[model samples]
Target: MEAKLWFILLCSVVALLLYVIGFWRRKAGEAAFAAARAAATAEDRDRYCRLAVMAGHREACKMFCLARSDFFEDHRPLEPFKSHGIKVVFYGYYYPSRYTDLLNEEQRAFCRSLYQFKEGENHGIGFFKACMSALKLDDAPYHIMFMPCSDEFKYARRFKRLDWYIRTHRKGRTSGLYDVDVFEPRDSLHEAKGGENRILERNYRITGDIKGKQVIIVDDVLTSGQSMADYKEEIERCGGKVVAAIFYGKTVSVPPMLLVKAVVWGGYIKTG
Candidate 1:
């Protein structure tokens, strides 16, 4: 009986030791992650603010201030506007939300470890760096216009976010100016299926005048060209031309013809 009791006690002690080790490791890992995230957030703020100061963009300075303070608090997933702006200047494409999914496990792990967004945010500082590293800012266009996002939220907050990022970062070197008021989506047909029928119902009307302006349409995803095409037609009707369309992801679940005219993350890949 004493021998059996000793064996049981030994087993219990081993199990307890294992549990303590695991608990310690978990806490250590969490602490490391938190520290890394804090560092990244600080770095992003400095980089963005420095760029804004160099460019002499008034609106960007305002955004930098907002980002620093806790005044504006929305938890929804935010898009990486810096990458979108930078990509538009060079390759006309930005990193997609799922772009990391395509990378090898090690590369993906590195990305996840390095970049972290605040609660309810999607991509983080790492995504912005990836996009910014693609090209030099001097090559960006003088006159850049942002297209409205989908019609779901009624306020077009995402579209406004993108517009804010571009206006602040691009810094318009030439005398030519940047305009954010052009297109506004009157309906939310993005989630609907089928082709031009849904696009017809989308009703993305021109709220502000785009007459005689060369527009650059930016969106999170480009599935069918219908919405963009519609925007182009309306802009043209008002004597404005659709100079280029920029998107983070071009979904490949659609027909092949649609991808031909669009520019998305890495250009050609199945996003479905």
Candidate 2:
């Protein structure tokens, strides 16, 4: 009986030691993650933010989403505006480089992150996906299409997120992903970036049957209203009705003070 008691006591002691080790290890890990998240520079935060986001840390994930009311709050949805004639809904206005400097440090960092996301940064896909949620689109059997790309979208990560958002937004109930065969242009139309809009022709052949479908057009930025106009015409020409067009930002040429006034008018700043 004493031998059996000794064996049980040994097993219990071993288990207790393991539990204590595991507990302190977990606490140490959490402390390390917190330190990384609170790093002074965005560059440092970015290095660890990826690991936190992948680990599903809620606070760390907040950096990659604009769902915060104090930041990129939802605007009045589905309001028609501008000359394009499509219902334009955007998260916020994108300012020029000089104007961007006026924002506070955190806000400026976010703006930089957004541009980085646009330039095909992989870890920034969450921001793009969060932008898509601003449209308040209902699961009413609507189709999704991205604007035509001459080759694979220069921002291919953002393109794939567009597809992923719609499909999972309502749990497997949306599709009509905008894909097109890359039409070799006559020459490198560098001006496709803007300054000369519709004069340069794009030979994008949209695929699949979008006939009689209500399509939602997705794009990075809406500027000059020309690319969107062309896409709208193409979808209509193919018998698809564009119900709404959503963008990450609309180019606004406001002076710095006016932009600051607009944000102040929003009453979205956090004070604690």
Q: Output the number of the TM-score-best candidate.
A: 2
User: What tens digits encode model 2's per-residue C-alpha lDDT throughout 1-272?
Assistant: 99999999999999999999877755554554575556677556544543444444444344433222233433332333545787777655554454442333655665576576466563433544454455566666777787654455553555665566557754634555545554564332322444435463666777778898888777766656677788899889988898887766655433233333344333324321
lDDT, residue 88, model 2: 72
Q: Candidate 1 residues 1-272, lDDT tens each?
A: 99999999999999999899877755554444334324445555434443433233333333333333222222112222333122232211222234443223433453343222211133322333333344333445434444444443432434444344555654542111233332445544444544326636433445555566555555444544566666666667866765555554333321132221132212223442
Candidate 2 clashes: the total is: 0
CA lDDT, candidate 2, residue 212: 89
lDDT of 2: 0.57
Q: Give the poorly placed runs of model 2, Cα more than 4 Å off.
A: 1-83, 98-103, 122-138, 153-155, 185-200, 255-272
Clash pairs detected, candidate 2:
none
Write out the backbone clash pairs for model 1.
none
RMSD (Cα, Å) for all candidates, in order, is 16.9, 19.8
Provide TM-scores for the models.
0.39, 0.54
Cα lDDT listed for each candidate: 0.41, 0.57
Cα RMSD of predicted structure 1: 16.9
